[model samples]
Target: MCRLALKTANEPFSPYEVLQAMEAMKEGYDGSGLGLLLRGMEFEDFKYNPRFPILSGIAHSRKAEQRMDEYMDDRGYELKYDHRFAMNPEKMSGKMRYRYFLRAYRMPPAFKDRPQEEREEEMLRTRLDLRRIGEENNGDLTVFSFYPDVAMIKEVGWPMEIGEALCLWDGQIKSRVCMAQGRQNTNYGINLYACHPFFIQGIATMTNGENTAFVPIRDWLLGKNIPGYIGYQSDSEVFAHILHYTLRQLKLPLQAYKHIITPLSSRELETHPQGDFLRGLREVCRRLIIDGPNAVIGTLPDETCMLVMDQKKMRPATVGGRDGAWAIASELCGVDAMVPDRDPAFDFQPMREHTVIIPPDRKELQIWSQHDQLPLPQAA
Candidate 1:
């Protein structure tokens, strides 16, 4: 599968640009599916109602649409803005079963003054309830993401073709950080839910290789008894969940993710300063250790974008950009397409021992080493 992520330090960029990057790496994907996750959005409605949570997905029928409206109304959610993409029937098969939607809703009256944590909990419950309803009704309605400043769209088609079908090139929903994946159907049977760039809470991730250790990782996540840890349609979904679990649930730093997923060997740990802590964490998170060939690209809540590789480092990945924009992709060609004028000397491929992390500020491109707590040389 091909994966690409773009993050602008200041100005919001179009998700179409990310699709362009993925399109450049067409050799790595078979065009089975395309998934896009846009965060820190700049839509007109969002600018006015920046605090409202956006519920994005597809409604398969008029009945499904009505059901969603009724459900939200019953829950006291005020519909602030309802924007539906006018899909091109000719571009997106005439028989397409669903219409894309990005609806922003004001919170229930009672949640208006509630703590942020409490409000977030209720939103998660609402999203899960809607998801369950969709599943029960044969996917009459499907919600990909329900959070503030985030929106997702996915379908089965070539990355750029799907973008055109969704009318994303119109540039209505631009974002500071956007991630797109051109999927190569392997074992998932071409399900939309199985598409990459999976998200949970505010964290999102897309992967390029198989997760041979998916079953155990999924089991461990489910065993955590988290409210939103139910979907396992894609093996790579676990990566996003793991990120949420590590950062939100476990309250660990972002750097700890590389350590948790690909911990240092015993001999290497021996020479490390936090060897004891690393040892304990390795044991505790053994099941979460990713096995098999894989490369991950993800974005945190703060719009910090990161790229990490499995211990084997089998998949191709690269990071490149200038002062205001940076991008990570599964291949050098993808990065080249995103930022063609970037200095080749600054563009680097992260190894199994490092994580390429670019904060929202875009002031520095940090290459963090898994073997040490300190950061390696950074882009100037």
Candidate 2:
């Protein structure tokens, strides 16, 4: 079931009123309801623009340039200069340049009997301004000579929605934790709607394996097994289930605090079919849950796990302690850095010691191939 909340410009048109209007439209058109409703509302005055937000200012600039070039090409006019509309001598060699110079420079000799060269130079200068105006207004059929609004849409409007959607969709993955943190001040606020089950499952399947764990979560909500307490059962309930499952898999023992620490980080999400980080995290979590907390060893095949040193607890030699103690973080840098040194006890090793795996699908490869493990070919 779909539950929609509408925010209208006026208070009198409540969300329920919008829903009723939608229902009426649906009744009027039968199966073609949504399309008919949209058609009816297409010309209505709405606060929000119906168009999808533009994503790149460069795209707009490129499109404008293409249109201008096409217009010039159709008119048999060669674009021989920069955006400012000045003629380029390089593009027009000896004969072409001379012809163009004659056309541009030749003027009535009655004004002043100037030398051919000097008159040509003066005429060229006079035509430069007019040529600039013509170039600037090329391909423009509207009363407004240039699409300044298009430029503004590209420069300011496009990136806003696109970036917001990106940040929202990407920030919830467990592996993208660092990147998501970096985007917290900007489009991250849209994480509310972006962290839905559809997005989560999409991220999970992005790496190496099918998102089997998320399937159950989806089933629990929409497959006639939903709990009565869930007032509005929808995709959001699936999100809650997956969040709970992730926390449980992580072995975070606090049931009361489930709400506080359920959502996985964007870093942990495996969107690519062969993303090692996603696969590794999933495997680690699966192993931990299956074999109990002590089964961290031998779970990650061909991978060296790092034991994070808890700075707050000030523990020096322990492998596991806090919630995120066993998880791998960035490598230690300075001599005085708090992170533990790579040792056999902690199962930590540099990339040089490990054999990297490359999945058959090229798109699943990580940005950095540090975690890739080459799979052996199956027997025929």
Candidate 3:
């Protein structure tokens, strides 16, 4: 199982802190890779350029570097900021080298003033197209994400070394929300894109256990006419796509996702207070059911984050935070690292079959039981 730690606050928050938490619990993962996604991002220069899409990834060679610049320009994305990372070479010498670059781009002129939703859809498709090009061109480029207010930083190394190499140990990036995952998967290749904290169209998720139902989930998602669904490098990526489908495509409520992915059982539904509606949903969307002992933590486009445990709660997750900040991690130790001196009254671990909704500021924590959610009463 991998380890995940998330920190979100009302004010500017640094993801470097989350990396520090992962470092404290480094013993759990081999540290083959690390993935970080930050929303409501903060950087000295990026502060003034809030509307541009921040594209961050690796350029494997000089040719790849030239291609990236050309692709962005030819596509009408004005390159506003291009910053290469400064790695601590002393710490990374002799290690497999991956060059990191962050480029902020103004949307193509045609996209300006379009409805917010349409612009988001356009940028998302563009990002996916760029990633596909990278894949087809032999991995010369890896475009992480192209969205406003979100920035991605990923690397292959032990948590501590990766943090140090990127100077995260001293906190160089800040955001209202940030998540870091110590990728430890026994079943997959060590691909960087396969790392946790998977993202698509503003929805992101990272899990801490195996997804036994991954095959069926991926098969179903691939059938959907969605562009961003192509990169299922990690089985867990479906969790993020399924979320996008449910909330964006189908236009369902947030809680409805819990039912679709981990719906109530037939036996339980028969007696469930929300029986009638639950039965209908199960009949229509049973393929979305996820069978697992996994714990999933994710963030919504609205800046709300969620922590959910499978009925078994086989994987561990803890909750902690103070008035302005909130955190959820595979272990409480990580949470403790975020809000070191928290109010004891606000700290607690969620039980099995539970879901916790934490806002961007993490000002309040809401818990819902899977089997206990009563469907809306049917009208006459």
Candidate 4:
């Protein structure tokens, strides 16, 4: 599958740009489906109610919609604003057989003043509950994300076809950061949940390769007993959960994620300053280690965008952009299409042992290597 991630320092941008880039790089992939994950929302309701969770999903019928409304009311979630897509009727059948809705809901009275962790946990539980209800009723409802300032859209169709059907180019749905994936349709068959750009809480990621170690990782995460980690519809979904577990649950540093998923060799670790600590992690997180050819591009709760590749470096990824905007993709041509006019010399592929990070500041981009003492920061 092809993936494109874009982040801008100033102004909200359209998801169309994301699909455009993916379309430009559509060669090997069949584009069986498209998934769009957006953050840093530019909608008016989001601007006014930034703290309220925005539920983005689909409902198969009016009965399902009524069930959702009643459930939310009983759970004490106050609806603040609602935005439903005017779906093109022709595309609303078969795999795309549902109505998409983006509703912003205020936290329940009990959670309004609760700790951030508690509030977030409740939100996740609510989403899971809704998902369970949907499954019990023959997939009547499918909630992708229930977090503030984040929205996701997944439909089985060509990038532009789905875009036009959803009326994404209308410009009402815009964000400062967007990660879009054009599915290549592999072993898993074509399912919406199996699409890339999977999200949980505030962590969203889209990968370009298969996870050979998916079962082990999924088992380990399920062992954690976190409801948000329940969905394994896509092997790559584990990547986002692993990130959330490491950063939010374990309270580990951002760089720790790179070491956990793609641990360095013993000899290489020995020369690193955090070698001792990393060695300990290698054993503890052994089950979490990925054994596949994958390139991951993700965004953190803090809007920090990052790209890292598997040890095998089988999947290609490139990062390039100018002062106020940046883009990462599976191909250089996609990057060129997203952020053109920048000096090509500055656009370099991240090495197998490296991680490219761009914090929300957007002032500079940092390149951190497993063997290096510090990340080399370059002017944005």
Q: Estimate TM-scores for all models.
A: 0.95, 0.17, 0.94, 0.94
* Per-residue lDDT of candidate 4, residues 1-380 (tens digit): 55555545456888888888877877847767788888888774445467888998888899999999999999999998888665675653445555788899999998878998888889889999999999999988988989988888888877877887787887888888889888887767677788878888899888888898999899999998877888788888899998998888767767778888999999998888767777887899999999878999999877899999998888888888877788888888788877886777888688888889988977667888877643212310
Leading candidate by TM-score: 1
Which candidate gets the maximum lDDT versus the true structure?
Answer: 1
* Lowest lDDT 10-residue stretch of candidate 3: 371-380
lDDT (10s digit) by residue, model 1, range 1-380: 55555545468878888888887788888878888888887874445466799898888999998888899999999998888675766776435656788888899999999998898888888898898889899888988988888889988888877777777888777888888888888877878888878888788999989998999999999999998998898888999998888888767778889888988999999999778778888999999999958999889878899989988888868888888888788777778877787887888888888888898888769888877663322320
Clashes of each: 0, 27, 1, 0
lDDT, each prediction = 0.83, 0.21, 0.80, 0.82
Q: Residue-wise lDDT of candidate 2 within 1-380, one digit each (tens)? A: 11111111111211122223223222111111010000001111222221211011111234444553454344333222221112333332221111111000113333245554453334333323233433466412111111000100000111123223223123121110110000111211232122211111111100101122343445443454422212221222233333334433343312211111121234533454335434455444332111101100000111112111111212121121112212121211211121123232433322211211112121121111223332312320
Off by over 4 Å in 4: 44-47, 90-96, 373-380
Per-residue lDDT of 272-377 in model 3, one digit per residue for the tens?
Answer: 7778887887778788888877888898876898888777778888888777888888887898898787875777777765678886556678787766764343
- Give the worst 10-residue stretch by lDDT in candidate 1: 371-380
Q: Candidate 4: global Cα-lDDT?
A: 0.82
Which pairs clash in model 4?
none
What's the CA error at residue 318 for candidate 2, in Å? 16
Q: Between candidates 1 and 4, name the one with more favorable TM-score.
A: 1
